[model samples]
Target: MDDIRNIYCVGRNYRLHAQELGNEVPKSPMIFSKPTHALVETTGQEIVLPGNRGEVHYEAEFVIHISKPYKPGMKVEDVVDQFALGIDFTLRDVQSELKKKGHPWLLAKGFPNSAIITKFRAFPGVEACKEVDFSLIRNGQEVQRGNIQDMLFDLETIILFCSQHFGIGAGDIIYTGTPAGVGPVTDGDRLQLKWGEEILGECFIRLG
Candidate 1:
């Protein structure tokens, strides 16, 4: 996690997710952020959840690992090709209240241990990322499944849009958003993120 400089997240970037959450599809991308310190080092450790933050939801996302320094004027094709699988944990109830008050989701979104990711790998190509199947399973049950075909904005578009707004730099990561079927995670739940038959990452939930 220390390798990442900034964490940029795109909210409701899947049509089904936006509809299920009753959020209107944005004309452009809806972006938010989490602090790099919020990243939990899970190399060989189980994830310990922050207590008393309301119901925390598990959102599986395709994480893009930037290979080079990026600025606003950069083109999408200039981005490096590394990627990974990860979970963007959200305090759903907290986010709801913040949304109602028309407030930014800093606390609700950027709390400690919110960003969990697997090791990065070279992205095969656009056709591969676009067609690859990914899913999130909790306690041995598949909960969220998505493919790049369903993304409202493809990978290049997401990176380009985010760079324009956030001034992405080297080692920055962009979470391209989650699919539908996101729900609360409880204590003792074992979570696994998979791409096809291969398990990309796993995190054990230990809530106090």
Candidate 2:
């Protein structure tokens, strides 16, 4: 986690997630970012978040790590070296207000500890990735499940967009976006991120 540089994220990349939030499907990849300081690794520790701000929502996503400098027309396998499950925690109320006012989501999305990631593992090429499911389990029940095949904007497209616009390179990570079933998480909640049958990470939440 210490080696991580830029944190890029995709918004509304899942069609169902867009409709669930009453948002239109984007014509292109909707990109946003968080400062590196926003990152927190999930290692069975207590993850604290703002409690007075409003509802905090959990968005489970497939996180990709870039291992080499991106070049135009490079395949996803060429640039990406690892993958992991992550949570794009959001201050829902703050985000809603920001949306209504047509403002940036920095306040709601870029807070410290808002970006939660698990340990990274070797990237098994794109084909093998599409066959598995990644999910979030809160307490004991599954809340969100997604696969790379379901993304409205696939990895290749997302990588291209980010590279062209944000200058993606080694050390940058992309939170590929969440699926439907997003909801608030309260203090004392136990969150688990999984890829297939393997538990990538787990942590308890503490609102402060």
Q: Please tell me which predicted candidate would have the highest TM-score against the true structure.
A: 2
The lDDT values for all models are: 0.84, 0.95
List candidate 1 stretches off by more than 4 Å. 41-44, 70-77
Model 1: per-residue Cα lDDT over 1-208, one tens digit each: 5678888999999999999989999888888999987776446358887668789989999888787866656555577668888889988999999999999999888887888888788878767677678999899999999997799987778887776777767788888999999999999889988899888888799876
lDDT of 1 at 98: 97
TM-score of every model versus the real structure: 0.93, 0.99
lDDT of 1 at 52: 87
Residue 94 local lDDT, model 1: 93
**How large is the C-alpha RMSD of every model relative to the true structure?**
1.8, 0.6
